[model samples]
Target: MEGLALILLYLAIPGLLFSALQRFLAGKKKSSSTAKFPGPEQYPVVGRVHDLDRFGMWLKFKEWADKYGPIYQTRMLNQPFIIVSDEKIAEELLVKRGHIYSGRPQIRSLIKHKDGPAYSALMDRHDIWKTQRKWCHAAMAEAYKHHFYGHVEMEMKRYLGLLLLDPARFLDYTREYCGRVMSRLAWDEATQGKANGESADQTLHCMSVSGPITNTMTPLWYLPAFANPWYNFEVKRESEQRAWWLNNLRLAKDRYRRGELPNDTWAYRYFEQIQREGNETLEQAEDQEIFASCMIGFLNLVGVVTISGPLKFFLMAMGLHPEWQKKCQDEIDRVCGDEMPTMANFADLPTVRACLKETVRWRSGVPLGVPHQAERDDEYRGVHIEKGTIILACEWSINRVPEKYPDGDNFRPERYLEPGWPTYQEPLTRYPNFREGHSMHTFGWGRRTCLGQNIVDDEMFVFGAATLWAFNSGPKTCPRTGKVIPIDTTATNAHVILEPSPYQMEFKVRSPERGKKVLENYHSVLGKLKL
Candidate 1:
């Protein structure tokens, strides 16, 4: 009877669904000493798998950190993971010991996908990662200079116009704005709008699913083919993304051969590298392919979702706190008057920038900086972290540490400006909030930090500044209760994105003159865009 019941359940449940239970059952016999560190006990195959949610597992680690102190150890699905919440410890591991700590785990999903090795953000640190990051670093530096896009300022004004017309579709506009900007930036004159939209939509859906977590779990990777809906979903989209990616590459390559591609954009720069070396061999081809992969992949995984999530949180926060909104609006009006917010004037409008910075700290997109894996066995502060052990510089917890941020959970931008508080040094931009001290940890640390941090900061401020300047965004009063709808910062969406749940907010034109200027800018800006 027991055998029959077991067989029946196996038939009913998919192999992927059974992966966690199977690992747990298989891990019953193994044990770990955790030595002197304070952490939950670890079993063989499952280790600390039981302690974490199969999705957004870092949140569970935060709960454990509350119990275990700043540094804690746990094993997930037979893989070991170390969580670092303190800045000092994070510096020792991710910064000082970066050689070993910079590596990304060799997750099966990142490996088997068509362009995974060449383009994935979650790639293990290797020659490819180094090569890809080096090129990306240069391109991103150019991209940070808003002038590089030629007509980016115009595009931004058009974005504001779109928002003013359809404030309710703010989320959709954000996705579209990033989609086109990235598409044009990557492909130059040749781009597929439908392909870009498809990539964004598919990747966005991929974000909402449990694809990443399920794939990284040790035992789950080997699940039968039929049970891999999560991996399969991402893989299919990647394949679709590759189609357009390869097409763009082909067009750019041909244009480069004819000396038609621009010098400033990534498309031209990548092909120029190839033409300079005069080595368009198989390896170079693969490198170019990976470059293409990285271009779309970075835009897809990092660019679109990164900007859109924070903007959502920014709107939610501004609505929840009216005083901040009014304060920012007054600052924007004083700084730019009837003109759309410009990066040049960003320093003068600190209040709007502070609100955006607070939103970043309050609910970061990648709360746990892209998971960095240990290259080999290493010890930090007497704790043993084995080779392949995953290390998360828990940005969520680090940003919220009470010692650094007083009343840490409270949404207050003023904390960063307070005297005697820890401050980070700003190099290229004047946004000290992101650069100085603990708050800067949102970009992660050491070699594995976010490559596009600068661009995200500038774009976020422009959007926030423009939105706050022309329109009023605040909590919408409930029709039934006759009370303002409460903003629930505590409630988070699935996966690593820490955005507030969908909430109601009111967005109305604050000034007809300013609003008219926005519409005029949109119309004029489109004509000015060189692209």
Candidate 2:
């Protein structure tokens, strides 16, 4: 009798939970079904997979977006998506109609595993996204534009000095700067200040989890991780790494409890607010959710490949093309006269700015950029696009579009100097080089744009200008004769991110006076940093 009763209880409990889950999902479906966008003529199960299988799908997406107009739809993984590429169309959906479109797409497996609310920026647009974005904006604004200028300048000086000493070590220097600057920001100090050894270790571990290791391994997702017995081992390895990352989060949580405050990171501010609210639920959300958000933000390192890639391209371009280097240095010398180029002097240094802009355009930081998934099925002209599709704007294609930018492959800063060019002279001019779909969508589009855009810009500009001012860049070997070559911009790869192939370069100091000045200010500036 007792055994029968236990069986009945088990069945009843599961049935109740299943019924409740069904009802919840049904309500969610009803709420989300209000909008319908255009899509390709494919059965629901197959969606737009056939259409996107073509070679150079990147270029094809822009062509389709133009043909389909704004507010189109498609599908992927049997999910509905909306695509908006034109500026007006993106504005309509992501801005004016933001209430409906702001919600991020959901990743089922990720959320099912409760991986702290899906890390894919392309997925999971919800209230959590809204909350995290709010905190991120505030944090970026506090650290980059206003608060962290001193640290940024110090790093810029170090980078400039390195250019004079060892050009071959450029990659290492760039990586160190990226690591240290990001580390400082993550740990909340102006420099390499550690609140505690465990906390610092936690930060490092969290970073390594998402670093190049995960990057190289992530493509394995294209293959089956489990289910197939042959793939089980790889899946287990990924699982182990994920577990380690979660443990690091727990360590961060403990540090928070111990009053280990971070002055540089946005997490500290948001978590503090959570604690101050005096609500146990909010406090929990603040601790866990905020930690999750920082992890997301720390994914900035993933995007560093974008910045570092282009910086090297710019350096190589300078090294190969000595004439352009001389022209830029002359302009810099005329404008700032060795005062260490500040943002205030940016306007006077238009030519210098143009070089950076042209560098970004010629060899964009992120060539493929983050892909935008369509939320609805929509059409422009006569193209047939379906819902739940993945669309790419292809920055390289658009930036190199001969019609929009004539002689697109050549590096010409003068084109932008014209009266009506996008970044032309204006009281409030935006940098043309950063990203171009709106604040240069190089960061991203719509609700999932990069939160670190401000710092990325400031650091790139500061570093680019400072390095040019300190030394003249040129290639060290000859291409044809196998002798000393010159750097050539056209040799860059148009991949996920545009970067110059490995090349040697020489950095010759423009003047002894400037060299001494950079050397004198380097350590003092670093000393002032609250490391």
Candidate 3:
């Protein structure tokens, strides 16, 4: 019995030693890899979690960038995040080495049912994401070739008339116009002149309620279902949204079958592509998969607010800096000459284009870009980045880089017009073209960049040109004091997307002839649309 006990003790001693050695080696490797990076001091376990604030987090990120240099690391719980403030670094890592960095982190609040279809662009880099992205690009390309500009023109005219009729609701009209145009392109349901307000409300609610909560660097999401009310709410919200989207999908499919939907509608183009391919190269051929892919058009309803934010900024800039507005109006008048602005006139109106570019740069909608996840272990400039690290490109900081944009806090379209500025290009006639990739970082970088960028450019140019041509926006005067109310450029940080805090401005027609022309164009389009 004594000999047997001695033999067992010897075996257990070696096993314990081996496990201890493995843990020591792992700790050494982790320490060595992360030692070179600069960041705020981390606390044990919590690891900078307390530093996160729901509001002005991007500002805090920028402050960190100023302190820690362009690239730095921050940890929350066990997750490591790399915050990138320089565009060059972003291009190198996210664009040049995109294959390794194009993955999306798992957003706990946005998780769909275990068996439900997922948003394609939001999904991590995989077979499903690839297939759905291909379908979306194909459908968008087809729609662009057919009826994209026509829809934008019609909607802009309608929006201008609405603005003239009720300038007090300009922001509301902006959102409605965006929603209507997207709805028309997505499902051809906007000819009835009603915006998809419900979808817009759903998107806003989801973003407002879940965005701030999930964006934090805590492990609140890991709480058990019994203890997590947000988790339960999100589950129910996602289920309802799924039903709403699926119902819309069914209605669109039914309309397509009845030949009621136009060939140019996104639904028609998507369905046609599916039929044409006939599963030859398709992997996800199930109804849910098709719905998920086709729903990119519906998902673009999120752009309604995103685009409206920039347009509101444009209005604010116009009111605050009337000189720039006058410059744009002069350019538009020279280019279009009393006629409504169109894509054909885009090249001749560089000032208008520059204003649009500057507005987005001044107040980016998605300040902290959607986080990207590292797919595999990699090294950049001797800094080790492990797999599953979250990469955040602080776009607000990137746009404000002093070297690229001088006086970045102020609104300045001249940056893109003058040769001294980093953003400027030669040949003044066509320098600041939005569609030619002039504002790349504003949308995003690499494969996960916003798919609706081209549409955004087109919509903004036409809407901006027409607005500047028709109205002169300025700060409203207080009736009691007869003083101009200052337009606060401060933005709200309720969600990931940033919008200017509620402000008032007065938009007046530049001339009665312009006002008459706006009404004429609106009535003419209204008649044709009714038919």
Top candidate by TM-score: 3
lDDT of each: 0.67, 0.54, 0.73
What are the candidates' C-alpha RMSDs?
A: 5.0, 10.0, 8.6
Candidate 2 per-residue C-alpha lDDT over 447-495 given as tens digits, one digit per residue, 9 for 90 to 100: 6677766666666777777888887666675556878774555554333
lDDT of 3 by residue, 399-475 (tens): 89999888998889999988788889867667686556455787778998877766777888888999998899999
Q: Write down the RMSD of candidate 2 (Cα, Å).
A: 10.0
* Pairs clashing within candidate 3: none
Per lDDT, the best of the predicted structures is 3
* lDDT-based ranking: 3, 1, 2
Candidate 1 clashing pairs? 423-436, 423-437, 424-436, 424-437
User: Model 1 segments beyond 4 Å from truth?
Assistant: 1-34, 43-45, 54-56, 113-116, 150-152, 189-209, 216-220, 226-228, 255-262, 279-301, 420-438, 477-486, 497-500, 528-531
Model 3: CA > 4 A from native: 1-34, 113-116, 146-149, 191-218, 222-227, 278-286, 289-294, 297-299
TM-score of each: 0.84, 0.69, 0.87
In terms of lDDT, model 1 sits at 0.67
